[model samples]
Every structure is written in C-alpha cells, then in structure tokens.
Target: MTSIDAARGMYFEDFAIGQELRTPERTITSTDIVNFACLSGDFNEIHANHEYCKRTPFGEPIAHGPLVYSIMGGLQYASGINDGTLLALLQIDAWRMLAPVRHGDTLHMRSTVVGKKETSRPDRGVVTFARRCLKQDGSVVQEMRATLMYRRRPPA
Candidate 1:
C-alpha cells in the first residue's frame, strides 16, 4: 500500500520480509548542524568549522553522523508505518556512515522488513528492519539493521 493509505501503524504480523516503506524527504541545513552541535556538546571541526573542513577530504562542513542517524529515527516515526504499533528499539547493528551529509542535501529513509519472529509473549513479536538513508541522487549515505519490538494483531 502507498504511504497515504498505510498511514496507520503496522503490527508485527502485518510485516513481511522484503517489504519496504519510504519516508518523506527532508533537507539538511547548516542550522541543523549548529543546533546539534549545541545539543550534543560535540564541537567537532568537521561538523561545525568550515575553515577546518576545507582542509579535509569532504572540503566542507558536514553533519554529525549521530545527528543524521537521529533524523532517520524521526523519519521512521513520521513514515507512520511504525506509529503506535512499535514498542521499542531492541538493537542497531552494522550501522555505517558511507558518505558525508552536508547542507542542502535532501534525503529520505527506506525501511525494509528483513526478519521477524514470535516472542514468548503472544501479544508482541520481534521484527528486524534494514534501514537505508538515501540522498536525493539515490546514493545511500548511511545504512543499518535495527531490531524492534512490535505488537501483534489484536483479537478481532
């Protein structure tokens, strides 16, 4: 189903392996970096100092990895596929930063269900999703696998 029709959250039983959901796009900005720097207390030159960044391979100030990762988390929620059905994030695995995210970069998240299993609790289950953060050009800038807890379908 399209995002418009699937705005409601999905239950554990609703997910199928290889099923993909794309989130609305977002643009990265300089103010985002500044705000993140202040909020995270991470004043790294590569993230907040243009002059310092000019000497680096990226040649420009880049957003913090964690900041972009955090944005992906928000995108996941905004996608609405995990809305109220999601219970908790169990784990993040093999998270990798493959490219620098700079100001004006439009990005979106693609989440695919990769695995699922019933838990001891009949009311909930575990789901593993492969998440990819892609730039407007279709380049994957970051990727990770996350395990989450989700409720099962309720009794009819």
Candidate 2:
C-alpha cells in the first residue's frame, strides 16, 4: 500500500448526489471473525461459537452485524471515497442485516450519494449516502444510510 498524507480533509462540496463509489473485493475468513469476536467482545454463538450456532434456524454460524458494518470503513478507505478527506461519521440510518455472511465469503461495498448540504461553518459540509455490502454472488449482506462531516478543499 502506498503511504498517504492525512493532513487534508474532504469538504462537503466534493460530493454529488447520485455519485456511486465501489470498493475492491475483500475476503472474509474464520480468523477474521475470531479476531473481531475477541476484539469487540461479541462472542455470540453465530459469530464465534460455530457448534452452538448449528441449533439455530440458519443452521450455521454467521458474522456479527456490526462486523459487517465495519466493512464499510475498509471500503471507504480502500476505494478512495473517503481517503484522507473524511472528518467523521455523523450518523447511520436504516441499517439492515440481510443474508448471513459465512467464512470464506468475498465481500464488496458500494455507496451512492443520496444528499448533500453545506454546513453553517464554511469549512465543512454534511454528506449523506446509501451504502451496501454485497457477497461475491451479488447478494446483499447489509445496507445503511450514513451521514458524514467533510472538510472543504482549501482555497488555492
């Protein structure tokens, strides 16, 4: 990976409604789940203890919802959609978990700008986007709408 300068921040003016951004594929493995489980203390049967999950309706272990959500961060950074520019995640809305994410699944993310508005402060703006995580087979695993604070490009 190339080194990045983190000094600059994105301004709300940079985004357009209907703009689409996609990320490269990311493979998820058992170790990834285990690490997330240990790091987040989310040791639920579906996410960590596979044998215990066999008794559930899904009949197998699934990834945690927040774990799936975390994928968005990787997507954002890797895709250059928010790289070095994003200031903060302000809010997320209508977050939904769909099909279960199993080990060895490949995931990708796409986001579309739904709206954008300039902030009262001249240096920043708010951007709202609809985001989705999809499996290799194109099945949607999770979806949400997010709002972020972005810094404006400095005047030349």
Model 1 gets an lDDT of: 0.93
TM for every model, in the order presented, reads: 0.93, 0.89
Q: Pick the candidate with the highest TM-score.
A: 1
Writing each residue's lDDT as its tens digit, candidate 1 over 34-139 gives 9999999999899988899999998999999999999999888888878878999999999999998999999899989999999999999999989999999999
Q: What local lDDT does model 1 show for residue 101?
A: 97
lDDT of each: 0.93, 0.83
Q: Residue by residue across 27-108, what tens digits does model 2's lDDT show? A: 8888888889999998887777668888888776777888878876886777776766788889999999888898888999
Error of 2 at 5 (Å): 8.1
**In model 2, which runs have C-alpha deviations exceeding 4 angstroms?**
1-11
> Clashes in each model (backbone N, CA, C under 3 Å)?
0, 4
Q: Where does model 1 exceed 4 Å of error? A: 1-7
